[model samples]
Target: STGGGLADYIPFIIFGAVALIMTAVIIEVQQAVRKIPIQSAQRTVGLRQVQSRASFLPLRVNHAGVIPIIFAISVMFLPTIVANYFNAAPVDTWYYKAAHWIQGNFAPDTTNLPMAITYNVLYFVFTFAFTYFYTAITFEVHDVADNLKRYSSFIPGIRPGRPTEDYLAAVMNRVTFAGACFLGFITVILPIATAKISGIPHNQMYLGGTAILIVVGVALDTMKQLQTQLVMRQYRGFIT
Candidate 1:
């Protein structure tokens, strides 16, 4: 009975340890923000001559980050549902056959060479497309511009308001596109690489690409929030 109790607790312990480690890694990544100093144009309430750091603007490289992956996973699932309607019994034969072919070729299993190629192509396209979609949804250049303006901060070379917003949006779009492509490659690459490097079976090595991205992204966000809290409170940051 005691041994059974111990066994039950073991899995939780293992999972907790992994979560902690993942969290640490995420924090490290998020804290990699590059802070660019922009002196404030207006003085603050307390200061006669504004004496603030007037610096520490955060530039998040992975701003769009794993959001594109989530969008891809969610959007890609809909096609499968449409295919399922065709696959229903006593339905159109050609539709069923086409659905079967697509399923056989692209379902995460049945990785014949041809199927693998098709999967890669579809995966890349969906990932890339959703990346753009997610960037538009998540990264609001206007918000950033507004925040900067409210703080009396503006980009060094760019004019304030609409011009600054446009420049920032352009930069973000370019970076987001690059990040999206990288994620697309990574979605396919990590599982394959893990399979090659580890003794895990291919199926097991297929460690849920979307899941991985979500886990990493959530962990990173949590860490950043924690870091902000610690900074506000003027305490030592996390040890683990």
Candidate 2:
């Protein structure tokens, strides 16, 4: 309420809240994962051959989550910020013209068709690229394959050595591609869609897709860890 009464802000508040709720729900839906089956082969245990056991490796669809969004936003604004510094330069100079172009096209103004298209396109590309880069660094197929080989575990129908790595790499690429697309959609499209459907301006509200992604991802991970701890405690108490 900037000099206005609380009554004047009620409608804005209501619509803003609804838009944020929608963003949260959409981000939660993107948390799905692809599970790869893992079979632990029989291993000799002190003159005994233990039976094989089956398990699965869960690879999250939004493995990078908020990280890519944060990175993309930071990179997306770099040119805009830099261009502002050069606005004092001579307008006739080539560098000044370049800076002017950057400032015009890089703004996140949804009402402007050309600026919105250029900004969102770059934002999506940056988010997609960052997701794959972060995923690769975090999840290494070579290490996963080596660990499986050492533990007498192997993916069904896949060999134990290089073939296993190759298969894992292929699956990871597919999963990462899906993750990249989801990140791109969440970062670039979700906000625009929210603004269009709810009639709420994004700059005036807290309808951040990154906020929902981080909150839902962290909440789910914490809950899963807590549940596992509780289960473990039920079988083996902490005291002894």
* Tens digit of per-residue lDDT, candidate 1, span 1-240: 999998776644544454455455444543455455566675657656665455656656556677666666666566666777776655557778878776666554456887776666677788888777766777787998888888788878888799888987777667666666667766766556544544344575433444655777777678879999878677544433
Q: Relative to the true structure, how large is the alpha-carbon lDDT of every model?
A: 0.66, 0.82
The superposed Cα distance between candidate 2 and the true structure at residue 100, in angstroms, equals: 4.4
Off by over 4 Å in 2: 1-31, 87-94, 110-112, 228-239
- Per model, how many backbone clashes are there? 0, 0
> Cα miss at 101, model 2 (Å)?
4.7
lDDT of 2 by residue, 13-67 (tens): 7667765675666555665778889999889999999999999988877777678
